[model samples]
Target: MQRNTYGQSPPLHHPVPQHVSTVPQLRSPPPPPGSAQSQQQGYAPTGQQGNPYQQQGGTSGNVFGAYGQFMNDPTAQVAAQFGQTAFKQGQEYVEQNIGRYVNVAALKHYFNVSNSYVINKLFLVLFPWRHKGWSRKQAVGANGQEGWYLSPRDDINSPDMYIPVMGLVTYVLLSTLIAGLKGAFNPELLGVTATTGLSVVIVEIIALKLGCYLLSISSQSQLFDLIAYSGYKFVGIIVTITVAEILNGGKGTGGWIGWAVFAYTFSANALFLLRSLKYVLLPETNGQPSGPMQTDSRAKRNQRTQFLFFYSYIVQLFFMWVLTRA
Candidate 1:
């Protein structure tokens, strides 16, 4: 059997035995006995010519009807809404009631005054060449999704890679757009916080589909697909900061920065959730979802996602230590 780019076995291959066969005849299964019809009708014993549904007693038509029924059910809607839904709603409810009392304008003023300090510190994390003199692109070889070796080359739109890219990019863009709109207009509105967070979750999931544009362009591994798109988000933060500085007369307004970061953090969670979902998503049978809703990976992904949510409010820590201190 041909090995995949990864050292591990590919998902597509049948499991092969460890030892090579020394005696082929001993391993072969005895042929099925001839049916009486073969003798009565003067038929030859060709195995391939038997009924198509020999062991499985049905046709493809039966499966199609079962799927049709699933689509028409209402309970599936409730299940779809409830994924990590409890915690997300609870957090939003708290943020809306809590954040309203704080003087948002004063907070914005503080952030504006602190912008230069923040910007100088943030330069290292944002601008690699200026700060660290180093750069990293998407992994070039077997570190990719196939579990192969350092396989050569990179393609952003590879079949395995495109879905994650779409899921990530759509997530970030939608969240940013929503937060920017909210901050630009109603920074302290309760609805903005709740709507934006829920939007992040919904878009994160909705983005998983294999779509028309991707069908035309995707040709990379799943890992590279995800990483490349995330690179663009890094670029986006740079752009947002540059614009923020210009609009706020050097130190950007706190309102805009807070909401933008809020969007960014939730989007990060979306990325983790989408990637973990990819891991366990076996091919659907009869149009059903592949695995249990609460797999181990699903739980891990949710933990990281939840961490991003709470951590977003204190993003100074992330930028200061992780990004600025580099």
Candidate 2:
């Protein structure tokens, strides 16, 4: 029985193979948590998740803007730039011309006449063809037909040019008429009675209106100021002519009348020439109401000068009425 017990214990043995027990299973371990490899492979991470805010690009709001502003031509912008520059330059020219030491308002008025003179003279000299065309065109009138403002001297389409020339001519003629009237009535003109000229005084009053019209047309030369000054000039010229005639009336028709008329015309012209300098220097700016500032589209013609030149035939009717009444 002792020998049988010892043999049974030695026969007991294990079932598993030696190689299979030594191998470690060779399988992948579970992903830790939120790994990039897990996401790329379409597998879930085990634990800690990723922070999306810390993405590769970081925060975004683009700092750059559009490059080219215009899609078409840029000519309009160029024109506007040049125009603004010219306007500013013109302003500077005016400031420099008047000086820092002159009565601003009075200076402005002087410039009104001066500007018109230069514009017309320049127009005539610079663009004679255009000026000729201006003269040929039928002008509109106050009577509703082709009107006359500057009759003979409308070579320029600008009113400032025509008005002053006509105004000066009218002043001279008015002086002549007054002198003629004085001779008509004054016995002293025949050398018998002693008297100052009276007919001329009345004519001077009427000439004032003509002056007013010119001033109004020229700007700052308003009819009122023009009228008064016109009357004064008439009286001065007429009185001088009349007195000369009275003193020389005894000389018969020895060309005294012609001499006096020549003197009156010349004197008026001299005054005009001097004043015209003001216009030439000051020339009208565009914003003003009158002078060259008036667009050529609106300025018709110089009716007065035309009347003196072409309508001299028509003046007889006016003279007849005035002579008979006065």
Candidate 3:
């Protein structure tokens, strides 16, 4: 080796040979089995390499393995059972107590009317001049006691809330349409119209109930019966408004033609109530007792009859007119 001027020895340079072999040398042999060096060198045993995942412990494998471990754990199984029990208990509690807040039976009865009954009821309400029988039929129980009033499907005279509910909805939609045609439409108008209609029905029902109490009219009439009867006036109001709209060529203004139709409908509604309510206000007895008691009863019955007539004609006409105007 020769030293440079900087006092650093020159690097050694090996001489090149002309005949160098091209075949590669063999790699080192793999480490023995079960040794750390074999694992580090990626030398897994033959049978062990068949399923590397099976060698994993705890939850260190794939999703299925982790899930299987969770399912097999005793604490996890107990937690799942507790959760299922809690859910079943909650469902049972709701089912048991749900009826307290709602009258499911009465609701079912009111909405049990059939389509044919609705059509006939509508016709009778509009043209009640020829309908003679007005008493609601009764269903006798196995013990021969009157169980309940016949449903509207079984008796034409039986009252139902189905027609009233549908009629109220139809009236609201139609009134909204008319308002739009008259250039008076607004988003609030629909709710206002519905509120007005409901308020009128509520007022009418209260008045009828008060009259029944004042006249000592003790019949089997339920609150829904009064509601059903009171709500029928909407049918007449609907007809009046429809006629007015037709006459005005959809201008939404009711002229004399509307008033004429209103009058006819008012009369028909009055007559209908006059006949129909007699069954409720003055129920027939098996036989009349001939004495001073009979006279007093007759007087009371007469008073009830007069009040029913006043309500049928005067009350109905006012309410019907109000609805048409609304």
Candidate 4:
């Protein structure tokens, strides 16, 4: 054996043999399973053809195993049951209180109201003084039956909600139009006006209901009747705004004509309400004996009714002022 300068041993030389290829042979590892080349080459991982989840049965074998069990477990069903129970409870609560807030029968009756009745009530709500008697007779239907439905008759029997509702919507639309013409249009104004008006009406209704309860006259009137009466102010508002809009021609505030129309409508509405609400506010003074006890009771009732009626007019005035100025 011979050693080089680095002290490494050198092997003895052997005779060289000629080969066809001189390049060194190299081998590459196989491509990963599911790769494009492996898939095309028909190479697949073991158990690849079986159910992926079943292949790895144990929780430790698959990452999604716990998640799958959690989804399929009764815990989810229990949660769903709880959610459904809560929803049902909420629905029942709403159903129970729905009538307290809004009378569905009144809404249906209003929807079926006659156009002529609506027109007549429009005038009647504005000019209720012309008809001295507030007692309204049930309108006879085509079948000759006295229908208990609401009409434009001069009474507090059935309050028509249609005119008030339609009048409110009309007021908003006309107000929006006027705003646009004056170059002061705003989308938010519509919502604000509507919500404000509705809030005012609802507050008035609640106040009137409370007042009636305090006066021991709640039994004499219905909730919908108070709502109807409170809503009637919108008719006069519609007229005043419309007339003001036309007369002012979308100018700065309203001129004499606008003020004039507003004043007229205001007085008309006050008179109408005064006459129309007297029956509801006051007890039956007619067709009854007028003794000392009766007279005293009648006098007290009249005083209260007159006071409330005047307060109602003041409220109407305030609401009208807000709506028109808004």
The candidate that wins on TM-score is 3
Query: Candidate 1 on 1-326: residue-level lDDT in tens?
Result: 67877777766868899998797566554344476644343334566535433324323334556667776677766766785698799987876777687544323322232334334423332332333211112333464432321211222111132222343444445434544655653445345434543444334323422331222212223323333233223333434444555565645424566446535543543343233223223212221222223323555555544443433323322332221111
Stretches > 4 Å off in candidate 1: 1-222, 252-326
What's the ranking of the predictions by lDDT, best on top? 3, 4, 2, 1
**Residue-level lDDT tens digits of model 4 in 1-326:** 77899999987798877765678878676479768876554444776745454333322344466668877899887998999999999987886789687665446664556666677677677776666556656657798766553443344335777778888888788888878888889999899888888888888777777776666663323666667777878888888887776677756337888778878787787777676666565545353221112224766786767666765678777877777777
Q: Identify the leading candidate in terms of lDDT.
A: 3
Worst 10 residues of 1 by lDDT: 149-158
TM-score of each: 0.21, 0.24, 0.66, 0.59
Candidate lDDT (C-alpha), each: 0.38, 0.39, 0.79, 0.68
Clashes of 1: 13
Q: Please, what are the lDDT tens digits per residue for candidate 2 over residues 238-307?
A: 3344455556663422265635553443344334322322232223453332355332332323433332
Global Cα lDDT for candidate 2: 0.39
Ranking by TM-score: 3, 4, 2, 1
Candidate 4 segments whose C-alpha is farther than 4 A from its true place: 1-103, 138-157, 285-296
Say which prediction, candidate 3 or candidate 4, comes out ahead on lDDT: 3
Q: CA lDDT of 104 in candidate 3?
A: 53
Least well predicted 10-residue stretch by lDDT in candidate 4: 287-296
Instruction: State the lDDT at 139 in candidate 3.
Output: 79
> Ten residues in a row with the worst lDDT in model 2?
60-69
Give per-residue lDDT, candidate 3, residue 46: 67
